[model samples]
Target: MKKGSATVAQLSEFDEIIDVRSPAEFADDHIPGAVNMPVLDDAQRARVGTIYKQVSPFEARRIGGALVAENLARHLHAHFQDKPKHWRPLVYCWRGGQRSGAFVTWLRMVGWDACQLEGGYKNFRRMVIDALAQQPATLDFRIIGGATGSAKTRILEALAAAGAQVLDLEGLASHKGSVLGALPGVAQPTQKKFETALHAVLSRFSPDRPVYVEAESRKIGRVHLPTELMEAMRGSPCFAIDASREARIEFLLRDYAYLGDDVADLQRKLGCLNRIISNETLARWQDYAAVHDLPALFTELVDQHYDPLYKRSQNSNYVRFGDAIHVSTDDLSPSGIIAIADAILAKTPVRADAR
Candidate 1:
């Protein structure tokens, strides 16, 4: 096949693909697993762009084309040149235009099949949007709501362990859904990547199995949930697992302390909190953390921060789930966890409510 001619279905079967857009564009969003191999580096891209605007398109290509060829030659030698000759590596530029198309031409000279994505990232993204639009409308969905730090995730883990088919939106998105939600060391994917990951996992779920999801808003970090999933979560039943405030507080610290013992990460994460918290409270929060008064710090955070946001989000615009249940007490105990799961099981059964 010619370069820039392969369809998405064909592209999906490849072992790998290359995206050749600007780094900024890639950072904004992209295919999750794609390795960026921009034929136009940042400096070269700017140079070409300036020429295209200030000089002339012809001069720009004359300059840009040479640089692109050199970069591709280096990529072939240092990286891809020695791989299996027939290896299927789909390549793309922003819109299956000159950049990737050019690379495919060069690759063909080297004896590789070298097909390009028909419409590049633009077309792949459209496929994702269409797939999300087709999410099962009558999914047997259930919410595993809980107070901050109740180890709701742990309970959900147990539920899945006990053979429940769970749809974990947070897990797919790599976020914990709060100011403290950033996982240790791992940067979250862009919205498009998140959507792609979500779709891949969600496709495996059957509408017949009950899927348990954490209560979340449309936005998780930089990514937003699909309209269909958010709507499904809204109409679906929610059951909150209430743990004693103390247990919740301890859990939050344990989960978040890894950011740093230095407290800078906590501050960085709290940049959003400053908008809502009083200036004095924000100052006091840092003060408390500095002195290592961890308990008091987290308590205020739960009351003034996490808990309040949770209540408002879990309440407003969100209809109270008609079918609701609770853990036995406002505390984290194994038995309490069991009771909560049992209650969820009683209310949301696989095959009928959530898939």
Candidate 2:
């Protein structure tokens, strides 16, 4: 009904969230569901800042205010013209600063129920950091360990389908966790965005039941796992998925078939390991790509590279590696993956009252 402020914890009480920061600032990270309604777009914000520093703060405000007014008018005419009078929106900017303040003031002027986020995106970011630091410690984590192509991600999916709680790190990171793990054309989120998503998922689970997650390195791609989450994962008990070399190669070929679309890109990604792999071997792998023999390429990559790296990391990083319950599977077909998931759920007995 009137202009006011809501803390980060109260964000969900609103009907819509509007971010009035510049495009670049919004792209970097904002509240998870916020829609960008920048009062001053990137170029305008830059122009205003330059004037503020070199000319005068008063001049800058005058120019920025005009720009904000014009942009806000355009947004309301194009975007909010159809909104009902009762529509409630939470608006925010870099620190509940002038950009967001201006937007909220005008929205309230129109008699729509609008409010500003107190401390803005910075407040929400601090909440994510604080939650990640303490939440993982309260839950029991079960790490899913395996060599590359072991279908650990698929197995986690099946586990979730079977009603077990899972924390899908790769899913959140939009990565597959290997040298060639990047999904085609899908960019990973900013580290803050990843952390915010992680905190959101973590907050939804009950602490009494064990949370299952794939065993991953400290960094998933460009995003580094929060220190507490990484440490908790390393210290958790593990359940290893053991698949044979042939099965792994077959599974990897089927799962990563998208690589076939761009052999050159595949070769380039594989070439990242030139220092670790002998040139002759790398050349042979590239040759396999040239001939369109993907199974051969995957075989060498798994048996020689991924397997050894996984063995070393799993044994060293996860302290409970020796005690892990190993689930042996002959293949990674649909049925085979389901069987593995069933075996894992059997091994991980849950109390009836556990979440």
Candidate 3:
């Protein structure tokens, strides 16, 4: 790598990664761990673009240059005040263009070893895409299969806590992988950002060690899983959690207790099932929510909707579903889930090749 520029692969060599793109751009997707320090913020970028299109390119640059200088000065006095003289940072903009180039030049003039990303976020994005396409197949995966409310995610969390390799798809997507899975006050990451998160996690995992993940449809909320990963997961061996109906209902009532806080919101979510569930049935479910009769609502949903859908999808999609090792559990509490995770870890000893 040159002293003034670096590639995506050289990300670790820097003391800090700085993205000089606008805040909106940074929010949509960015290199993992990169800090946002916009040379031209959203409004300023829009103003400059308008000028470039309507007035002249030269005029836009003249105005944008002043704004960049002002923002950089503010950043130096405020954000960068504690930085040491030897701090080495990698700076990038959308396309490794004027914004990051100007920022890097100013930093180098300040006697800091600041390099521009060779192709900026565009290059990094390409690397993420390529990694997502190829990396998932390299790992050994174990699917956690179960009906809705089976606490599969909890089991995966327990496995991770017990020092096992686990890929949490739902957590990464910020959705629970159902119509009612949207988390309160939490927005899901953009599809690109989700893919970036996936790449980051997969890069850290050891391929020889079994990576436990929950079974999911191709689409989780709004973002879709990579085709490569979906294919890899379908072909991998599975462990089915055969929790009893009562246990599942109890688990769900506890897990989805948040839904009971706002009866109107809960009814609105239930209204989404109007197409599949009859009007009378939907009205009855809404009434249950209105009355806070969660047990009845969950029981009907499990027996009528989630369980049937899960059965069909698992049988049709997962090649190894029938052959899955059935792990029975009547308890879905934290302690019980931990016990299950421990049993799984003990049963599947790490292979010598994994080490």
Q: Quick one: best TM-score, which candidate?
A: 3
lDDT of 1: 0.77
List the candidate 2 regions with Cα displacement exceeding 4 Å.
1-3, 351-355
Residue clash pairs of candidate 2: none
**In candidate 2, what are the lDDT values of residues 219-260, reduced to their tens digit?**
887888999998888888889998887888889999999988
Better of 1 and 2 by lDDT: 2
- Mind giving the per-residue lDDT tens digits that candidate 3 earns over 1-355? 6669999999999999999999999999999999999999999999999999999999999999999999999899888878999999999999899999999999999989999999899999999999999998799988899999889999999999999999999999999998889899899999989999999999999977899999999999999999999999998888889999999999999999999898998999899889998999999999999999999999999999999999888978888888887889999999999988887777664652221
Positional deviation of residue 250's Cα in model 3 after best superposition, in angstroms: 0.2
lDDT of each: 0.77, 0.90, 0.92
| Cα-based TM-score, every candidate | 0.85, 0.96, 0.97
**lDDT string, candidate 1, 1-355, tens digits:** 5533698777568778778887877777777688888898888899999999999999999999999989988888888856788776788877889998888888777887778888888898898899888884756677777767877776787688777878777787788877778787778887777888887777778877778877777887667888888887787767777778877777667666665475777766666678788889889988776676777888888888778777766766346554556654564556666666666677664444432
Write the number of the candidate with greater TM-score, choosing between 1 and 2.
Answer: 2
Alpha-carbon runs more than 4 Å astray in model 1: 1-4, 136-138, 161-163, 264-283, 329-347, 353-355
